[model samples]
Target: MNWTDSLEIAIALDEAHPDISPLTVGFVDLREMVMALAEFEDEAEKSGEKILEAIQMNWIEERE
Candidate 1:
């Protein structure tokens, strides 16, 4: 999924890291984790703080 696919990425992250807390994760770690996902396929350099924040927010919502 691309950077714009926040819900899909969040779902993947939730399933991949059920025990981890998204709220405690830093943007750097979060980006790495997203890049590591098998389904993720996007330009590495395309991600910006805004997209990362959206993904993080979605992940937090997924947890709740």
Candidate 2:
């Protein structure tokens, strides 16, 4: 999944880190986590703040 696959990334993140709070995640860490996901496949330099924010927002929604 790439930057556009925010919901998928969020789901993976939730499953991978169920103990963590999305609200406390920084963009840098979030990006790294996304890149670390086994299903993730994208250019590392293609991500930006907007993509990270979208991922974080979806992660928050997933927790709720």
Q: Which stretches of candidate 2 lie over 4 Å from their true place?
A: none
In model 2, what are the clashing residue pairs, if there are any? none
For candidate 2, what is the lDDT?
0.95
Reference-based lDDT, residue 38, model 2: 94
Residue-pair clashes per prediction, in order, are 0, 0
Q: Write the per-residue lDDT of candidate 1 for residues 1-64, one digit (tens) a residue.
A: 9999998999999999999999999989999999999999998899999999999999999899
TM-score of each: 0.96, 0.97
